[model samples]
Target: MLLLLCLSVLSQAAKAQETWEVFMEKIPEHLQVSLLIQDEEGQTLFSQSADKRIPSASIIKIPILIALMEKVENREITLDARYSLQATDKVGGAGELQHLPDGSGITFRYLAEEMIRISDNTATNILIRAIEMGYIQDWLKKNGYRDTQLNRLMMDFKAIEEGRQNYTSPREINDILLNLWEGKWLKEDSRAEIMHCLKGCADNSTIPSLLPAGTVVAHKTGTLDYVRGDAGIILGDKPLILSVFVENFESMEEAESAIGKIALKAFRDFGR
Candidate 1:
Protein backbone atom coordinates (compact mmCIF):
# COMPACT_ATOMS: atom_id res chain seq x y z
CA MET A 1 0.00 0.00 0.00
CA LEU A 2 2.78 2.42 0.83
CA LEU A 3 4.50 1.76 -2.47
CA LEU A 4 1.29 2.30 -4.41
CA LEU A 5 0.62 5.47 -2.46
CA CYS A 6 4.10 6.76 -3.14
CA LEU A 7 3.75 6.06 -6.81
CA SER A 8 0.49 8.00 -6.93
CA VAL A 9 2.08 10.98 -5.15
CA LEU A 10 5.08 11.07 -7.41
CA SER A 11 2.84 10.83 -10.45
CA GLN A 12 0.65 13.67 -9.22
CA ALA A 13 3.71 15.74 -8.40
CA ALA A 14 4.65 15.56 -12.05
CA LYS A 15 1.28 17.01 -12.95
CA ALA A 16 1.50 19.75 -10.28
CA GLN A 17 4.89 20.76 -11.63
CA GLU A 18 3.32 21.46 -15.00
CA THR A 19 -0.11 22.91 -15.52
CA TRP A 20 -2.07 22.05 -18.70
CA GLU A 21 -1.77 25.44 -20.35
CA VAL A 22 1.96 25.63 -19.66
CA PHE A 23 2.51 22.04 -20.75
CA MET A 24 0.56 22.41 -24.00
CA GLU A 25 2.17 25.69 -24.88
CA LYS A 26 5.17 23.53 -25.66
CA ILE A 27 3.02 20.65 -26.94
CA PRO A 28 1.23 22.01 -30.04
CA GLU A 29 -1.90 23.79 -31.12
CA HIS A 30 -5.63 22.90 -31.04
CA LEU A 31 -5.62 19.70 -29.00
CA GLN A 32 -7.21 18.84 -25.65
CA VAL A 33 -5.23 15.84 -24.49
CA SER A 34 -5.19 13.76 -21.29
CA LEU A 35 -2.66 11.00 -20.75
CA LEU A 36 -1.37 8.63 -18.05
CA ILE A 37 1.66 6.35 -18.00
CA GLN A 38 2.19 3.66 -15.35
CA ASP A 39 4.31 0.60 -14.69
CA GLU A 40 3.48 -3.12 -14.58
CA GLU A 41 2.65 -3.04 -10.87
CA GLY A 42 -0.19 -0.57 -11.36
CA GLN A 43 1.85 2.37 -10.08
CA THR A 44 1.57 5.43 -12.22
CA LEU A 45 4.95 6.38 -13.65
CA PHE A 46 3.62 9.53 -15.35
CA SER A 47 0.38 11.21 -16.29
CA GLN A 48 -1.25 14.32 -17.81
CA SER A 49 -4.81 15.17 -16.87
CA ALA A 50 -4.90 11.60 -15.69
CA ASP A 51 -8.01 11.91 -13.58
CA LYS A 52 -9.92 14.45 -15.61
CA ARG A 53 -12.99 13.26 -17.44
CA ILE A 54 -13.19 13.55 -21.25
CA PRO A 55 -15.19 12.05 -24.01
CA SER A 56 -14.25 8.36 -23.96
CA ALA A 57 -15.02 7.47 -27.59
CA SER A 58 -14.65 3.72 -28.11
CA ILE A 59 -12.77 3.37 -24.84
CA ILE A 60 -16.17 2.91 -23.22
CA LYS A 61 -16.08 -0.57 -24.74
CA ILE A 62 -13.61 -1.67 -22.07
CA PRO A 63 -16.15 -1.43 -19.27
CA ILE A 64 -18.81 -2.93 -21.43
CA LEU A 65 -16.51 -5.88 -22.12
CA ILE A 66 -15.93 -6.36 -18.39
CA ALA A 67 -19.64 -6.27 -17.70
CA LEU A 68 -20.35 -8.93 -20.27
CA MET A 69 -17.64 -11.15 -18.89
CA GLU A 70 -19.00 -10.66 -15.36
CA LYS A 71 -22.46 -11.68 -16.50
CA VAL A 72 -21.01 -14.79 -18.01
CA GLU A 73 -19.33 -15.60 -14.71
CA ASN A 74 -22.60 -15.24 -12.82
CA ARG A 75 -24.34 -17.53 -15.27
CA GLU A 76 -26.58 -14.52 -15.78
CA ILE A 77 -25.81 -14.95 -19.46
CA THR A 78 -23.82 -17.40 -21.48
CA LEU A 79 -21.31 -16.64 -24.19
CA ASP A 80 -23.55 -18.64 -26.45
CA ALA A 81 -26.55 -16.49 -25.80
CA ARG A 82 -27.77 -14.92 -29.00
CA TYR A 83 -28.10 -11.13 -28.85
CA SER A 84 -30.35 -9.86 -31.60
CA LEU A 85 -29.71 -6.35 -32.85
CA GLN A 86 -31.94 -3.74 -34.40
CA ALA A 87 -31.56 -0.79 -36.78
CA THR A 88 -31.78 1.62 -33.84
CA ASP A 89 -28.16 0.99 -32.73
CA LYS A 90 -26.31 1.60 -35.97
CA VAL A 91 -23.62 4.27 -36.17
CA GLY A 92 -21.13 5.44 -38.78
CA GLY A 93 -17.41 4.60 -39.18
CA ALA A 94 -14.98 1.69 -38.55
CA GLY A 95 -17.40 -1.24 -38.79
CA GLU A 96 -18.19 -3.01 -42.01
CA LEU A 97 -20.12 -5.66 -40.09
CA GLN A 98 -22.79 -3.18 -39.10
CA HIS A 99 -23.90 -2.89 -42.69
CA LEU A 100 -23.75 -6.58 -43.45
CA PRO A 101 -26.63 -8.84 -44.39
CA ASP A 102 -26.62 -10.79 -41.11
CA GLY A 103 -25.18 -8.19 -38.79
CA SER A 104 -28.32 -8.03 -36.69
CA GLY A 105 -27.94 -11.63 -35.54
CA ILE A 106 -24.88 -12.33 -33.41
CA THR A 107 -23.97 -13.90 -30.07
CA PHE A 108 -23.33 -11.85 -26.96
CA ARG A 109 -19.71 -12.99 -26.91
CA TYR A 110 -19.26 -12.17 -30.59
CA LEU A 111 -20.59 -8.69 -29.96
CA ALA A 112 -17.96 -8.22 -27.27
CA GLU A 113 -15.21 -9.41 -29.60
CA GLU A 114 -16.40 -7.29 -32.51
CA MET A 115 -16.41 -4.09 -30.48
CA ILE A 116 -12.82 -4.51 -29.39
CA ARG A 117 -11.45 -6.04 -32.57
CA ILE A 118 -13.16 -3.79 -35.06
CA SER A 119 -13.90 -0.83 -32.80
CA ASP A 120 -17.41 -1.40 -34.00
CA ASN A 121 -19.91 1.32 -33.12
CA THR A 122 -22.94 -0.87 -33.70
CA ALA A 123 -21.31 -3.72 -31.82
CA THR A 124 -20.78 -1.46 -28.81
CA ASN A 125 -24.33 -0.21 -28.75
CA ILE A 126 -25.64 -3.75 -29.06
CA LEU A 127 -23.61 -4.89 -26.06
CA ILE A 128 -24.64 -1.85 -24.03
CA ARG A 129 -28.31 -2.57 -24.62
CA ALA A 130 -27.74 -6.26 -23.92
CA ILE A 131 -26.06 -5.64 -20.58
CA GLU A 132 -28.46 -4.31 -17.99
CA MET A 133 -27.96 -0.71 -16.88
CA GLY A 134 -27.80 -1.70 -13.22
CA TYR A 135 -24.73 -3.83 -13.89
CA ILE A 136 -23.05 -1.30 -16.21
CA GLN A 137 -23.36 1.72 -13.88
CA ASP A 138 -22.89 -0.19 -10.62
CA TRP A 139 -19.73 -2.02 -11.71
CA LEU A 140 -17.66 1.18 -11.82
CA LYS A 141 -18.90 2.32 -8.40
CA LYS A 142 -18.15 -1.08 -6.94
CA ASN A 143 -14.62 -0.83 -8.26
CA GLY A 144 -14.02 2.67 -6.79
CA TYR A 145 -14.22 4.33 -10.18
CA ARG A 146 -15.58 7.83 -9.56
CA ASP A 147 -16.11 8.58 -13.24
CA THR A 148 -16.84 6.40 -16.30
CA GLN A 149 -20.08 5.05 -17.60
CA LEU A 150 -21.60 3.40 -20.73
CA ASN A 151 -24.93 5.12 -20.55
CA ARG A 152 -27.06 4.56 -23.64
CA LEU A 153 -25.65 2.76 -26.66
CA MET A 154 -23.13 4.56 -28.85
CA MET A 155 -24.23 6.88 -31.64
CA ASP A 156 -27.75 7.18 -30.40
CA PHE A 157 -28.33 10.08 -32.75
CA LYS A 158 -30.43 12.02 -30.31
CA ALA A 159 -28.12 11.30 -27.40
CA ILE A 160 -24.92 12.10 -29.29
CA GLU A 161 -26.50 15.23 -30.71
CA GLU A 162 -27.41 16.29 -27.17
CA GLY A 163 -23.70 16.03 -26.16
CA ARG A 164 -24.15 12.77 -24.30
CA GLN A 165 -20.93 11.19 -25.47
CA ASN A 166 -19.78 8.71 -22.82
CA TYR A 167 -17.32 10.37 -20.49
CA THR A 168 -14.38 8.85 -18.53
CA SER A 169 -11.02 9.82 -17.08
CA PRO A 170 -7.72 8.20 -17.99
CA ARG A 171 -7.07 7.63 -14.28
CA GLU A 172 -10.27 5.73 -13.47
CA ILE A 173 -10.22 3.59 -16.58
CA ASN A 174 -6.47 3.05 -16.30
CA ASP A 175 -7.04 1.75 -12.78
CA ILE A 176 -9.51 -0.72 -14.17
CA LEU A 177 -6.95 -1.83 -16.77
CA LEU A 178 -4.32 -2.16 -14.05
CA ASN A 179 -6.67 -4.34 -12.04
CA LEU A 180 -7.23 -6.51 -15.06
CA TRP A 181 -3.50 -6.78 -15.76
CA GLU A 182 -2.94 -7.78 -12.13
CA GLY A 183 -5.81 -10.27 -12.24
CA LYS A 184 -7.56 -8.48 -9.38
CA TRP A 185 -10.48 -6.89 -11.19
CA LEU A 186 -12.69 -9.81 -12.21
CA LYS A 187 -13.17 -13.54 -11.81
CA GLU A 188 -10.56 -15.81 -13.36
CA ASP A 189 -12.76 -17.13 -16.14
CA SER A 190 -14.05 -13.67 -16.83
CA ARG A 191 -10.57 -12.19 -16.90
CA ALA A 192 -9.42 -14.67 -19.49
CA GLU A 193 -12.43 -13.94 -21.66
CA ILE A 194 -11.95 -10.20 -21.37
CA MET A 195 -8.31 -10.46 -22.37
CA HIS A 196 -9.25 -12.66 -25.26
CA CYS A 197 -11.71 -10.08 -26.46
CA LEU A 198 -9.22 -7.24 -26.12
CA LYS A 199 -6.58 -9.20 -28.01
CA GLY A 200 -8.73 -8.89 -31.08
CA CYS A 201 -8.74 -5.07 -30.98
CA ALA A 202 -8.49 -3.75 -34.54
CA ASP A 203 -7.45 -0.14 -34.05
CA ASN A 204 -3.71 -0.15 -33.36
CA SER A 205 -2.53 3.33 -34.35
CA THR A 206 -1.66 4.87 -31.01
CA ILE A 207 0.83 3.48 -28.47
CA PRO A 208 1.07 0.24 -30.33
CA SER A 209 2.09 2.02 -33.49
CA LEU A 210 4.85 3.81 -31.62
CA LEU A 211 6.27 0.70 -29.97
CA PRO A 212 8.61 -1.98 -31.28
CA ALA A 213 7.32 -4.49 -33.75
CA GLY A 214 6.07 -7.71 -32.09
CA THR A 215 5.50 -5.88 -28.78
CA VAL A 216 2.18 -6.96 -27.34
CA VAL A 217 -0.33 -4.19 -26.62
CA ALA A 218 -3.93 -4.61 -25.55
CA HIS A 219 -5.39 -1.23 -26.35
CA LYS A 220 -8.58 0.45 -27.56
CA THR A 221 -9.11 3.65 -29.52
CA GLY A 222 -12.02 6.08 -29.77
CA THR A 223 -12.60 8.64 -32.53
CA LEU A 224 -15.10 11.14 -33.80
CA ASP A 225 -14.82 14.47 -35.62
CA TYR A 226 -14.30 16.27 -32.32
CA VAL A 227 -12.53 13.53 -30.34
CA ARG A 228 -9.63 11.10 -30.62
CA GLY A 229 -8.48 8.66 -27.92
CA ASP A 230 -6.40 5.50 -27.35
CA ALA A 231 -5.72 3.66 -24.10
CA GLY A 232 -4.28 0.29 -23.15
CA ILE A 233 -1.41 -1.76 -21.70
CA ILE A 234 2.06 -1.73 -23.22
CA LEU A 235 4.02 -4.95 -22.83
CA GLY A 236 7.67 -4.99 -21.76
CA ASP A 237 9.82 -5.66 -18.71
CA LYS A 238 8.92 -2.13 -17.65
CA PRO A 239 5.39 -2.27 -18.99
CA LEU A 240 3.26 0.85 -18.69
CA ILE A 241 -0.41 1.71 -18.90
CA LEU A 242 -0.88 4.68 -21.22
CA SER A 243 -3.86 6.58 -22.62
CA VAL A 244 -4.15 9.68 -24.83
CA PHE A 245 -7.35 11.58 -25.56
CA VAL A 246 -7.33 14.62 -27.84
CA GLU A 247 -10.59 16.44 -28.10
CA ASN A 248 -11.71 19.57 -29.97
CA PHE A 249 -8.67 19.37 -32.13
CA GLU A 250 -8.12 21.59 -35.13
CA SER A 251 -7.28 18.73 -37.44
CA MET A 252 -6.88 14.97 -37.46
CA GLU A 253 -3.30 15.24 -38.65
CA GLU A 254 -2.30 17.30 -35.64
CA ALA A 255 -4.20 15.18 -33.11
CA GLU A 256 -2.61 12.02 -34.48
CA SER A 257 0.83 13.55 -34.35
CA ALA A 258 0.32 14.82 -30.79
CA ILE A 259 -0.74 11.40 -29.53
CA GLY A 260 2.31 9.73 -31.00
CA LYS A 261 4.72 12.40 -29.84
CA ILE A 262 3.40 12.57 -26.25
CA ALA A 263 3.30 8.79 -25.86
CA LEU A 264 6.83 8.43 -27.17
CA LYS A 265 8.16 10.96 -24.67
CA ALA A 266 6.01 9.60 -21.84
CA PHE A 267 7.15 6.02 -22.39
CA ARG A 268 10.82 7.02 -22.49
CA ASP A 269 10.74 9.45 -19.55
CA PHE A 270 8.91 7.08 -17.23
CA GLY A 271 10.91 3.99 -18.17
CA ARG A 272 14.16 5.82 -17.58
Candidate 2:
Protein backbone atom coordinates (compact mmCIF):
# COMPACT_ATOMS: atom_id res chain seq x y z
CA MET A 1 0.00 0.00 0.00
CA LEU A 2 2.80 2.47 0.88
CA LEU A 3 4.60 1.76 -2.36
CA LEU A 4 1.42 2.33 -4.37
CA LEU A 5 0.80 5.64 -2.63
CA CYS A 6 4.32 6.85 -3.41
CA LEU A 7 3.98 5.88 -7.05
CA SER A 8 0.61 7.60 -7.35
CA VAL A 9 1.99 10.87 -5.98
CA LEU A 10 4.97 10.74 -8.32
CA SER A 11 2.68 10.11 -11.28
CA GLN A 12 0.53 13.07 -10.43
CA ALA A 13 3.54 15.36 -10.04
CA ALA A 14 4.92 14.27 -13.40
CA LYS A 15 1.59 14.89 -15.09
CA ALA A 16 1.38 18.36 -13.59
CA GLN A 17 4.90 19.18 -14.79
CA GLU A 18 4.01 18.04 -18.29
CA THR A 19 0.86 20.12 -18.27
CA TRP A 20 2.85 23.24 -17.30
CA GLU A 21 5.37 22.66 -20.07
CA VAL A 22 2.60 22.43 -22.64
CA PHE A 23 1.08 25.66 -21.38
CA MET A 24 4.45 27.40 -21.63
CA GLU A 25 4.79 26.38 -25.26
CA LYS A 26 1.55 28.20 -26.10
CA ILE A 27 2.71 31.57 -24.76
CA PRO A 28 3.86 34.13 -27.32
CA GLU A 29 7.63 34.48 -27.64
CA HIS A 30 7.69 38.27 -27.41
CA LEU A 31 5.71 38.74 -24.20
CA GLN A 32 7.19 38.83 -20.73
CA VAL A 33 4.98 36.63 -18.59
CA SER A 34 5.04 35.85 -14.89
CA LEU A 35 2.57 33.40 -13.45
CA LEU A 36 2.01 31.32 -10.34
CA ILE A 37 -0.66 28.82 -9.36
CA GLN A 38 -0.91 27.43 -5.87
CA ASP A 39 -3.25 25.23 -3.91
CA GLU A 40 -5.15 26.46 -0.84
CA GLU A 41 -2.35 25.33 1.47
CA GLY A 42 0.32 27.52 -0.13
CA GLN A 43 1.85 24.65 -2.15
CA THR A 44 3.06 25.82 -5.53
CA LEU A 45 1.40 23.85 -8.31
CA PHE A 46 3.12 25.74 -11.13
CA SER A 47 5.19 28.88 -11.56
CA GLN A 48 7.08 30.83 -14.20
CA SER A 49 9.03 33.94 -13.29
CA ALA A 50 6.88 34.12 -10.16
CA ASP A 51 9.35 36.33 -8.34
CA LYS A 52 9.90 38.85 -11.10
CA ARG A 53 8.51 42.27 -10.21
CA ILE A 54 6.27 43.85 -12.84
CA PRO A 55 4.32 47.10 -13.03
CA SER A 56 1.30 46.61 -10.81
CA ALA A 57 -1.17 48.96 -12.51
CA SER A 58 -4.42 48.69 -10.57
CA ILE A 59 -3.70 45.34 -8.99
CA ILE A 60 -1.96 47.37 -6.33
CA LYS A 61 -5.49 48.12 -5.12
CA ILE A 62 -5.58 44.74 -3.38
CA PRO A 63 -2.89 45.86 -0.99
CA ILE A 64 -4.65 49.17 -0.58
CA LEU A 65 -7.88 47.37 0.22
CA ILE A 66 -6.23 45.23 2.84
CA ALA A 67 -4.43 48.17 4.38
CA LEU A 68 -7.68 50.08 4.63
CA MET A 69 -9.42 47.09 6.18
CA GLU A 70 -6.64 46.80 8.72
CA LYS A 71 -7.29 50.34 9.79
CA VAL A 72 -11.00 49.66 10.05
CA GLU A 73 -10.32 46.64 12.23
CA ASN A 74 -8.13 48.69 14.54
CA ARG A 75 -10.63 51.54 14.96
CA GLU A 76 -8.24 53.89 13.19
CA ILE A 77 -10.96 54.54 10.62
CA THR A 78 -14.55 53.70 10.01
CA LEU A 79 -16.20 52.55 6.83
CA ASP A 80 -19.00 55.07 7.22
CA ALA A 81 -16.63 58.01 7.22
CA ARG A 82 -17.31 60.18 4.20
CA TYR A 83 -15.10 62.27 1.95
CA SER A 84 -16.17 65.02 -0.41
CA LEU A 85 -14.65 64.55 -3.84
CA GLN A 86 -12.50 67.47 -4.92
CA ALA A 87 -11.84 68.39 -8.51
CA THR A 88 -8.23 67.34 -8.14
CA ASP A 89 -9.29 63.90 -6.87
CA LYS A 90 -10.78 62.99 -10.23
CA VAL A 91 -8.55 61.06 -12.65
CA GLY A 92 -9.19 59.50 -16.01
CA GLY A 93 -9.33 55.70 -15.82
CA ALA A 94 -11.61 52.70 -15.37
CA GLY A 95 -14.22 53.98 -12.89
CA GLU A 96 -17.56 55.75 -12.69
CA LEU A 97 -16.38 57.77 -9.73
CA GLN A 98 -14.56 60.08 -12.08
CA HIS A 99 -17.79 60.97 -13.80
CA LEU A 100 -19.51 62.10 -10.63
CA PRO A 101 -19.74 65.81 -10.00
CA ASP A 102 -17.09 67.44 -7.86
CA GLY A 103 -17.87 67.81 -4.14
CA SER A 104 -19.83 64.58 -4.20
CA GLY A 105 -19.94 62.82 -0.87
CA ILE A 106 -18.61 59.23 -0.73
CA THR A 107 -18.08 56.87 2.09
CA PHE A 108 -15.02 54.82 2.87
CA ARG A 109 -16.97 51.61 2.35
CA TYR A 110 -18.23 52.69 -1.07
CA LEU A 111 -14.74 53.77 -2.09
CA ALA A 112 -13.32 50.41 -1.05
CA GLU A 113 -16.02 48.55 -2.94
CA GLU A 114 -15.49 50.55 -6.14
CA MET A 115 -11.73 50.27 -5.90
CA ILE A 116 -11.94 46.51 -6.39
CA ARG A 117 -15.27 46.12 -8.21
CA ILE A 118 -14.56 48.67 -10.92
CA SER A 119 -10.81 49.19 -10.42
CA ASP A 120 -11.80 52.76 -9.69
CA ASN A 121 -8.91 55.20 -9.97
CA THR A 122 -10.61 58.02 -8.13
CA ALA A 123 -11.84 55.76 -5.35
CA THR A 124 -8.37 54.32 -4.90
CA ASN A 125 -6.83 57.77 -4.64
CA ILE A 126 -9.35 58.83 -2.00
CA LEU A 127 -8.73 55.70 0.06
CA ILE A 128 -4.98 56.10 -0.29
CA ARG A 129 -5.13 59.63 0.97
CA ALA A 130 -7.41 58.60 3.80
CA ILE A 131 -5.30 55.63 4.78
CA GLU A 132 -2.05 57.50 4.21
CA MET A 133 0.57 56.01 1.89
CA GLY A 134 3.07 55.70 4.71
CA TYR A 135 0.71 53.53 6.71
CA ILE A 136 0.05 51.24 3.79
CA GLN A 137 3.76 50.97 3.02
CA ASP A 138 4.58 50.14 6.64
CA TRP A 139 1.74 47.62 6.75
CA LEU A 140 3.00 45.85 3.61
CA LYS A 141 6.56 45.75 4.90
CA LYS A 142 5.46 44.52 8.31
CA ASN A 143 3.40 41.84 6.60
CA GLY A 144 6.43 40.65 4.56
CA TYR A 145 5.50 41.87 1.10
CA ARG A 146 9.00 42.52 -0.24
CA ASP A 147 8.16 42.85 -3.95
CA THR A 148 5.01 44.99 -3.61
CA GLN A 149 5.13 48.78 -3.39
CA LEU A 150 2.63 51.66 -3.59
CA ASN A 151 4.82 54.45 -4.92
CA ARG A 152 2.25 56.72 -6.58
CA LEU A 153 -1.44 57.35 -7.02
CA MET A 154 -3.47 55.95 -9.88
CA MET A 155 -3.31 57.61 -13.35
CA ASP A 156 -0.36 59.69 -12.24
CA PHE A 157 1.51 59.88 -15.53
CA LYS A 158 3.91 62.57 -14.42
CA ALA A 159 4.96 60.41 -11.47
CA ILE A 160 5.37 57.44 -13.78
CA GLU A 161 7.53 59.56 -16.07
CA GLU A 162 9.64 60.38 -13.02
CA GLY A 163 10.17 56.62 -12.44
CA ARG A 164 7.58 56.23 -9.68
CA GLN A 165 5.63 53.05 -10.36
CA ASN A 166 3.84 50.39 -8.32
CA TYR A 167 5.14 46.83 -8.64
CA THR A 168 4.43 43.33 -7.32
CA SER A 169 5.39 39.75 -8.19
CA PRO A 170 3.22 36.72 -8.85
CA ARG A 171 4.63 34.93 -5.82
CA GLU A 172 3.92 37.89 -3.57
CA ILE A 173 0.40 38.21 -4.89
CA ASN A 174 -0.20 34.49 -4.55
CA ASP A 175 0.89 34.71 -0.95
CA ILE A 176 -1.64 37.49 -0.38
CA LEU A 177 -4.44 35.48 -1.93
CA LEU A 178 -3.53 32.36 0.00
CA ASN A 179 -3.50 34.27 3.25
CA LEU A 180 -6.91 35.73 2.45
CA TRP A 181 -8.22 32.27 1.59
CA GLU A 182 -7.02 30.91 4.94
CA GLY A 183 -8.52 33.92 6.78
CA LYS A 184 -5.19 35.02 8.23
CA TRP A 185 -5.02 38.80 8.43
CA LEU A 186 -8.45 40.26 9.08
CA LYS A 187 -11.53 39.38 11.06
CA GLU A 188 -14.19 37.26 9.44
CA ASP A 189 -16.38 40.26 8.72
CA SER A 190 -13.55 42.21 7.19
CA ARG A 191 -12.42 39.26 5.08
CA ALA A 192 -15.96 38.71 3.86
CA GLU A 193 -16.26 42.38 2.96
CA ILE A 194 -13.11 42.27 0.88
CA MET A 195 -14.19 39.04 -0.78
CA HIS A 196 -17.53 40.59 -1.62
CA CYS A 197 -15.84 43.42 -3.48
CA LEU A 198 -13.52 41.05 -5.33
CA LYS A 199 -16.30 38.71 -6.40
CA GLY A 200 -18.15 41.57 -8.05
CA CYS A 201 -15.20 42.71 -10.14
CA ALA A 202 -16.57 44.52 -13.18
CA ASP A 203 -13.82 43.59 -15.62
CA ASN A 204 -14.26 40.01 -16.73
CA SER A 205 -11.91 40.04 -19.71
CA THR A 206 -8.99 38.31 -18.05
CA ILE A 207 -9.06 35.60 -15.37
CA PRO A 208 -12.79 35.22 -15.39
CA SER A 209 -13.23 35.73 -19.11
CA LEU A 210 -13.03 32.18 -20.42
CA LEU A 211 -14.08 30.55 -17.19
CA PRO A 212 -17.36 28.70 -17.00
CA ALA A 213 -20.34 31.02 -17.12
CA GLY A 214 -21.11 30.77 -13.40
CA THR A 215 -17.67 30.30 -11.91
CA VAL A 216 -16.95 32.50 -8.89
CA VAL A 217 -13.55 34.20 -9.05
CA ALA A 218 -12.62 36.62 -6.30
CA HIS A 219 -9.87 38.42 -8.15
CA LYS A 220 -8.35 41.76 -9.19
CA THR A 221 -7.05 42.86 -12.60
CA GLY A 222 -4.58 45.53 -13.70
CA THR A 223 -3.91 46.92 -17.15
CA LEU A 224 -1.78 49.48 -18.95
CA ASP A 225 -0.77 50.06 -22.56
CA TYR A 226 2.01 47.50 -22.15
CA VAL A 227 1.11 45.59 -18.99
CA ARG A 228 -1.72 43.33 -17.87
CA GLY A 229 -2.27 41.23 -14.77
CA ASP A 230 -4.89 39.37 -12.71
CA ALA A 231 -4.66 37.77 -9.29
CA GLY A 232 -7.24 36.11 -7.09
CA ILE A 233 -8.74 33.02 -5.51
CA ILE A 234 -10.80 30.74 -7.71
CA LEU A 235 -13.41 29.32 -5.37
CA GLY A 236 -14.43 25.74 -6.10
CA ASP A 237 -13.65 22.11 -5.38
CA LYS A 238 -9.89 22.69 -5.47
CA PRO A 239 -9.76 26.43 -4.90
CA LEU A 240 -6.46 27.75 -6.27
CA ILE A 241 -4.54 30.96 -5.87
CA LEU A 242 -3.60 32.15 -9.35
CA SER A 243 -1.70 35.22 -10.53
CA VAL A 244 -0.64 36.00 -14.10
CA PHE A 245 1.16 39.11 -15.37
CA VAL A 246 2.12 39.97 -18.92
CA GLU A 247 4.19 42.92 -20.07
CA ASN A 248 5.47 44.35 -23.36
CA PHE A 249 2.55 43.07 -25.34
CA GLU A 250 1.67 44.58 -28.70
CA SER A 251 -2.04 43.98 -28.48
CA MET A 252 -4.24 44.39 -25.39
CA GLU A 253 -6.55 41.66 -26.63
CA GLU A 254 -3.66 39.23 -27.00
CA ALA A 255 -2.39 39.87 -23.50
CA GLU A 256 -5.85 39.50 -22.02
CA SER A 257 -6.43 36.33 -24.01
CA ALA A 258 -3.18 34.87 -22.78
CA ILE A 259 -4.21 35.51 -19.22
CA GLY A 260 -7.63 34.00 -19.81
CA LYS A 261 -6.09 30.87 -21.34
CA ILE A 262 -3.76 30.45 -18.40
CA ALA A 263 -6.64 30.84 -15.96
CA LEU A 264 -8.92 28.41 -17.80
CA LYS A 265 -6.15 25.82 -17.97
CA ALA A 266 -5.48 26.13 -14.26
CA PHE A 267 -9.17 25.80 -13.47
CA ARG A 268 -9.47 22.65 -15.56
CA ASP A 269 -6.26 21.11 -14.23
CA PHE A 270 -6.55 22.01 -10.54
CA GLY A 271 -10.28 22.29 -10.11
CA ARG A 272 -10.60 18.54 -9.69
Q: How far off is residue 271 in model 2, in Å?
A: 1.2
Q: Report the alpha-carbon TM-score of model 1 versus the true structure.
A: 0.84
Q: Give one digit per residue, the lDDT tens place, for model 2 in 246-267.
A: 9988899999999999999999
Distance (Å) between predicted and true CA of 66, model 1? Answer: 0.5
Tell me the whole-model lDDT of each prediction, alpha carbons only: 0.76, 0.91
**For candidate 1, what is the lDDT?**
0.76
Q: How far is candidate 1 from the true structure (C-alpha RMSD, Å)?
A: 4.4
**Local lDDT at 263 for model 1:** 64
TM-score result, candidate 2: 0.97
Ten residues in sequence with the least summed lDDT for candidate 1: 16-25
Q: Please give me the total number of clashing residue pairs in predicted model 1.
A: 1
